[model samples]
Target chain A: MPTRIFGDIPGIPEGSEFESRVMLSHYGVHRPLQAGISGSQLEGADSIVLSGGYEDDEDLGDEIIYTGHGGRSLDTGQQVTDQQLARQNLALALNCQRGLPVRVIRGYNHRSPFSPTEGYRYDGLYRIDSYWRERGRSGFYVWRFRLVKLVTVGAPNQVDEERQTYGETRRVDVTIQRIVRNTEIALHVKELYEYQCQVCRTLVFTSAGPYAEAAHIQPLGRPHNGPDTLTNLLCLCPNHHVMFDFGGFGIANDMGLIGLDGQLHQKANHRIDRQFLAYHREHFLMNP
Target chain B: MPTRIFGDIPGIPEGSEFESRVMLSHYGVHRPLQAGISGSQLEGADSIVLSGGYEDDEDLGDEIIYTGHGGRSLDTGQQVTDQQLARQNLALALNCQRGLPVRVIRGYNHRSPFSPTEGYRYDGLYRIDSYWRERGRSGFYVWRFRLVKLVTVGAPNQVDEERQTYGETRRVDVTIQRIVRNTEIALHVKELYEYQCQVCRTLVFTSAGPYAEAAHIQPLGRPHNGPDTLTNLLCLCPNHHVMFDFGGFGIANDMGLIGLDGQLHQKANHRIDRQFLAYHREHFLMNP
Candidate 1:
């Protein structure tokens, strides 16, 4: 049941602290141990913690505000009634109507120097930017929200879930041009493989960096065009650049590891150009 | 240093069991705790257990003999000297001169009913087949070896290790004839995706069976020769069949998940042929 993760969790970072809330539910940042919201009115909200627990929250180090859970009164912290929007408050109003972001964290309390003087911190992705209902200081009503801070990384409006298959599902889109190489030659072969994976040398990391990819070795476009040079790149690790462009494995003029199981770590000043590994074993191996 | 595995470790099986040897080193199975051998002499002996710590070992369910560690005597099991051929006994004589295999396990003692009435069990993959050096009954000069028990899976003498890649490395081998298809229509679309992965339902397993991989949505050879029909297969799982034959992602006509990040999950009576997803978005999505 942990699958809710909206913005950044991979390799966590932002102010990062944690010591409890069961270590922010073991690094999912804020996974409700006593419920300061975590998610679900059906999959909407994906995190939250803030911990000034509502006398109208308002953290302000990168804007927060928060509140929304239930009537209050954990033994006279007062309020006692009117607070329902329903489950994780309609899951943070469906991450403010689906622009999604969430995460946040903060916690500790001594009255907000942006909180955390003892435990939870995380402070990273936000964007709920609006929500309301009001009336507080114990006269009831409650709800609130607000949010903000999500510095940079804006494009791709978040959506990534692959792993699909089902034959004959009519999918169709076909516009073609191809040869799109030199993004600084795939970031110079992914910083010459420090981003790893020349076939399983692995190196994932992610809150957006250290990932690895490059790949191409022959065929840059239509009918085996094969070349956008740097001897046709290779870095790999997006599952070995889609298993070396979909023909699962092959590479052996002494840099061994022919294919399938894994472990070919080589590094010596890279050198791949054996005619693009003989055009990937003549157009991708079919059992030999 | 563990990473010596040879025939089968993925999803362990053969009699399985383990309660300690530190729970068989947290399931890389027999990874030495009180050391009854577990690889290295530059990667050789990958695992062994055998309960009777060598009184001229024997066991014999499908054949055994074993022994070879050091010359005995923790007190009076005697022969405390002359036993070297070097660590893990030249790693079980380099798995009896490289026919590789190894793993074994057993360890329970009452002197064998095929052992294991208690702690370890595993009993699978053996093959050392012969070693020698002899002289003991507690007299000294030991070593023995022999083994056996592998059972079937004959061919593929086991090499498998792709992930080696060095630029300019002279790799070559091009014999292309292609068109192989029909292994029962990719095992009937991998048992209609019960072998899961239609995008990422994932199914892994691997004691040798449940792994997925049918792929093909188009290109079956050369200039996209396409066809071998079933509206061009898909099953996937080897990293989504190399990111849908390396375009990485593209299946929208209502199935969404276009080019990367991933989470597609669809299922129904498979039907896929939209001109093979429009020939994989015009020969592998070059963005847009």
Candidate 2:
């Protein structure tokens, strides 16, 4: 007795019997491809054989069997004969479960008629009839298959691992840079001038930004020994930075503020006025 | 003869006369609070004064002297006396100078004032004439004078140095706390799970904040070994944190996800999926 199978029905385990019921609900849905043995050609022969797989019928075979290149006499094996060719044709049709519109195309560079020449095209296509027939002669049968399912999931299929690794590594690198910058600036300021301002008592941040500007006591443009050195730099606010830059002020021999015109007086009256000087005298670096 | 003594200003050693002029101009325009002198009494004194070794003025003894205690008497100190005070008062009236309001209440804090009692009623005021008359015959007088001037302008009296210092110190402390918190959290995450996630290949951040969150693999309220061990903690984002907290999704013995129904599936299909498991398989620590 030949077993029966439904090509459209999913091959689920016995425990998942509900799957067949669900699939049957969509049975009327048209499928262009069909796979099964054909019964018409092999009439009135002793033990008539159907090469293709069985499908809801006992007289047909469960799979197709390839009889090789046809259109030749089987008894003589010399010339292509009509009867031998007919048998081969029957075998191909039964094995492939013919009567389906699905077609298989193959080539190294095949272009679809509807697609652009530069775009991708189907390189090979094998109808269900031919596929089953080819597999039957190779001693293979009952190939299990499942429908392709789509899902909108996080992370793309390609390069997801690489992206994740790169993101993680980049995050760590950024964090380390912040820490190193903070510590390096602090240590540099501490080492130079012993962490003290020459004209103000502010000693909070040593970073190179708005709060603390690494000032050049001697002009950067001027020829000096260590313009970039911490010793030549004084951390100052914008106002004092301008004053010092324009020679409106200077540190006295005793490290006091000497006003413009070479006066040690708080005459210019900039932000670093006398009161600030007093603070500096009490707190700034004594030898800077 | 009036004598003159000139000393270079504290910071301006060259005596920068222009600086003195600038200081005078600043005092005239900005009107900084007078230091080291009572303002209301001496309206005509220069920015600086010369002390003649405690000797009294001898130029105008005949003028009247007003005492702080609501009394008036003849000037008896040598050639100069109340006449100088009268001249200064006349100069104030003539718009050459202005006198500050006399603070009659002594030791009465301006910020927090105390009610006056009988004993301290005239605390800040006293009579110089009566003080002298009470001690001797008539009144003694001597003669000596000199000239000096202000050289530097300082901050207004409103600038509270102590309060500013306190504020700066507070800001520094807060910054340090933030830095320390960031470092501690980062280090904690690095140590836990040995710097890898059991479900994803994300690395711990060196800085704090949104980089990492502590996760309990089993759960907090469970009776298992959820007592804050490095093994129990898995650093994750807010999304992953919530998913692992409420959803019954967990890593199986092979580090693959075991869904809520205890089904061990390498392929994730549910909402709380284990898509990040592939990276973790290669990077994360596996016990078995």
User: What are the lDDT figures for the candidates, one per model?
Assistant: 0.60, 0.26
Error of 1 at A198 (Å): 5.8
- How well does candidate 1 score on lDDT at residue B275? 74
Clashes of each: 34, 23
Per residue, candidate 2 scores C-alpha lDDT tens digits across B1-288 of: 121111121232311222222352342311223231222232222222111212232212111112211112435423223122223222221111111111122111221232222111211111111101111122422111111111112222111111111112223223223223333443465444454443443432210111334554443221122233444445553323433442324455454554423333222321222333332222121211
Q: List runs of model 1 lying over 4 Å from the truth.
A: A1-105, A109-189, A193-234, A238-268, A271-288, B1-106, B110-190, B193-234, B238-288
For model 2, the stretches where C-alpha displacement exceeds 4 angstroms are: A1-288, B1-187, B192-196, B203-210, B221-225, B260-288
TM-score of the first chain alone, every candidate = 0.23, 0.22
Q: Score the docking of each candidate (DockQ).
A: 0.01, 0.01
Q: What TM-score would candidate 2 get against the native?
A: 0.15
Per-residue alpha-carbon lDDT of model 1 for B182-264, expressed as tens digits? 43466577777687887768565421124466767765532345676666787766655644553446676666667656545
Residue range with the least summed lDDT across 10 consecutive positions in model 1 chain A? A170-179
Tally clashing residue pairs in candidate 1. Answer: 34
